[model samples]
Target: MKVDVQLLKDICEAPGAPGFENPVRKLIIEQIKDHVDEYSIDNMGNLIAIKKGTKNPDGKKVMVAAHMDEIGFLVSHIDDKGFIRFQTLGGFDPKTLTAQRVIIHGKEDVIGVMGSKPIHVMKPEERNKPSKIDEYFIDCGMSKEELEKKIEIGDPITRERELIEMGECVNCKSIDNRVSVYILIEALKNIKSPAFDFYGVFTVQEEVGIRGANVSAHSINPDFGIALDTTIAYDLPGAQAHEQVTALGAGTAVKIMDAMTICDSRMVKFLKKTADSHQIKWQPEILAAGGTDTSGVQRMGKNGSIAGAISIPTRHLHQVIEMAHKDDIVGSIELLIAALEEIDTASWEY
Candidate 1:
């Protein structure tokens, strides 16, 4: 599909914890500032960019949200032996933290290893039980005084990993929304003439809550919206087919509903029709749990928006090695661009 692997890699690897989105926001602005008609960063760190439409006489606006923040942690305490305790910023499974690497952002970037009780010491009952978040600590291999020189309290900590392609899929740490960020950037570059004024927003703190999207939507008050994010692809060795919400390498996903929002009926139909018309491969997404920035983009605006999402099928979501099919990634960009261009032709009337 001729995907830009390097660009996606850079975006995915950049560190941007919830409420600490500076690094990602800078990278996004560098990639998209000139491509859009106008761009600005809001107080909450959402990067809002716009491109004027060709045929919008009513000044309709379509807001596209792609959250830039990844689930991360904040340093809460540093012990006498240089071990660090942290408070989580987003949902994190404790099992994923054992033996994983993390980068603590203080005066300088300090690498630390996640440490927990050794399996050799665990009792039979404890051996099978899942670890809790409080059981983990960061080991920096330094003394209290030495670690204190380079570290500080409340610094953001992010998972350490690099993006790589594995046959037909790409795997990385922040593929959840960074992949969507890359899609939005590429969509902006490829869009020739949007049907309505395009408001592409790289939202911040979404990993914590829908803070950035909430504020941005209220200000833009868009008539229509499309959120770009990753959805769970549980197509593993499970025995049941219905349990697999989506599948890797299948295609892009058109939103029906998630734990947070039910996509507007018209928007859902429009996305399906657009994909069918363009021959863009797609699958239906009905996530049983977890939500995206769709909640804010759909309802936080003044009059609310006819909003839905174009989801990339992702595997191992929220873990260190999240994966997404290259074909689904490519198809998501195509579907988003097609949806933006053809939005005006849809019968939005309820």
Candidate 2:
């Protein structure tokens, strides 16, 4: 069955920067309340929703996590010309900063455009050199005095890109984990099998670090964990075959290793077997850089528990135009449900 594109769009468009995820948290709670047995928000802003199984209450615990935070900017300084100087809350390519519009969240909403020195107005040496994020400023079309009336330091800023349909794929900002979040929600809605008690965690502050997951994992102490996230798809021109981590439209990605976590092999095999039995499309991923909440959950308690990740192949991650295939998302949800249904607690060790 097809997932609702409008729901995905709404989740992606919601503004939830690191350390500020109330808006997104509320949206998720509303969507999954009926499907879960219990739900609560931790002190660090992680939203945890539980789905109990028919088995014993002391049965195995399974946690599925997706982060709700997106990469954005924070107001650092405002200049005399009403220009806003900012510091990045996460990683950004300086090349992508020119001429982009941003929403500055102050006491009130303020729209601004990223401003940089035009090449025509720059020196010959400067024209050939690439720009740095520090060289950029946001113009809000107000005087310094007037700007103070609206915006202030520590205000959040987000990319001003709208979700759009391109051919068969959907593109928007924050699709990295939002798409994964949607997958988990859809899976929980359709699950009807006997399995361990499940916890769907929508974590915060992931773009800055896996801060929320670290705390949530400790609270749940799950016996098994799966982090739903997005992985890079370097399938564009000039990228080599080996460098292409995964490709869009191929299938859902099962990550073996990334920079932070080495996935549990038994859990990986179990997911793969379930996908095969259910005829779900899937791919294997080995990310060279970056990590996800899997790392935190894998080492939460004494010696921790089995942990792995199911990732969607995404193009232009951390950018305004992130892309993912519709079929891959469906496949991810199917695979997750199948695994949950077929997982044998007696076979697993610790």
Candidate lDDT scores, in order, read 0.93, 0.87
User: Model 2: per-residue lDDT, tens digit, 250-328?
Assistant: 9999989999999999888877777888899999999999999999888884558799999999999876669999998
Model 2 TM-score on a 0 to 1 scale? 0.96
- Candidate 1 stretches with Cα past 4 Å from truth are none
Runs of candidate 2 with Cα error greater than 4 angstroms are 56-58
Best by lDDT: 1
**Per-candidate count of clashing residue pairs (backbone under 3 Å):** 0, 0
Q: List the pairs of residues colliding in candidate 1.
A: none
Worst 10 residues of 1 by lDDT: 236-245
**Model 1, CA-based lDDT:** 0.93
